[model samples]
Target: MSEVAVRMRLLQQSFDAFDESAAARLGLNRTDLRCLDLILAKDPMAAGELTTAAKLSPAATTTAIDRLERAGFVTRSRDAANRRRVLVAATEAARAAEREVYGPLGEAGTSALRRYGEEQLAVIIDFLETARRVQEEQTARLKKLPVRE
Candidate 1:
């Protein structure tokens, strides 16, 4: 595999391990925890936006939101301007849960970045921004493609 692919795989493995360990501690499944985290990160997102961000089908997103609401981790409200629109937001409990779960991981990442000098850190940030742009372009391209056998 290419170096980028290898690095991405390693990063994904590390993230999955971290998430699984945290999920066990929180007594929640990885998916449930992820949904809560996303809600915490971006409050009052429409149900459709949640489905797109979570890469889940509409039905799965609805079920996930239902579970989160029942667990008191999130709440759903109708948009004041658009009553037909449903928005989901994280509860205070969910914010606390995120801090408890990901605070250490964030600290570790920050420490690693600090290990690099300012110039190196700047380069790393530029590379990450470029990667983000490239990923967005690729996603748009893929969305435009027709299904194939």
Candidate 2:
């Protein structure tokens, strides 16, 4: 692999480690954390939407939501437009926790990026977006494959 590819792999590994640590610190499993992240990104998100975004089965998504609700990270409510539909939203506690855990990292990242010019930042942004798209595409492809147990 090229140096860039190796660096990208290392970056992914580091992110995975960070996610694991963050979830543990918040008293949550990785799946629950991932669900919480989706909820935070789209506050008051539909439960079904969360299930799709998290790539979880309905039952698994329910369990994750239950765990998050119990941990004060998320809450479930009936959607106003459709009483039968459920929505999940991050709680104030979850927001506070996120700020406590990720605020420093965000600040550091901003500081690091300050040295880069606009064009350099644009290139970086493009690379990250492309990487994210590739990851999403790969995840969908894997989900299509048969289970290998």
Give the best candidate by lDDT.
2
Instruction: Show model 2 residue runs off by greater than 4 Å.
Output: none
Instruction: List clashing residue pairs in candidate 2.
Output: none
TM value for model 1: 0.78
Candidate 1 clashing pairs, residues 3+ apart or interchain: none
lDDT tens per residue, model 2, 1-149 = 49989999999999999999999999999999899888988998999999899989999999999999999999899988999999998999999989988998899999999999999999999999998999989988999999998
Q: What's the residue-level lDDT of 115 in candidate 1?
A: 81
In terms of TM-score, the best-performing candidate is 2
Cα lDDT, model 2, residue 82? 96
Per residue, candidate 1 scores C-alpha lDDT tens digits across 1-149 of 49988997798699799889987887778887888778777897899888998889999999999988888888999999999989999888888878887888889889878889989989988978987898789999998999898
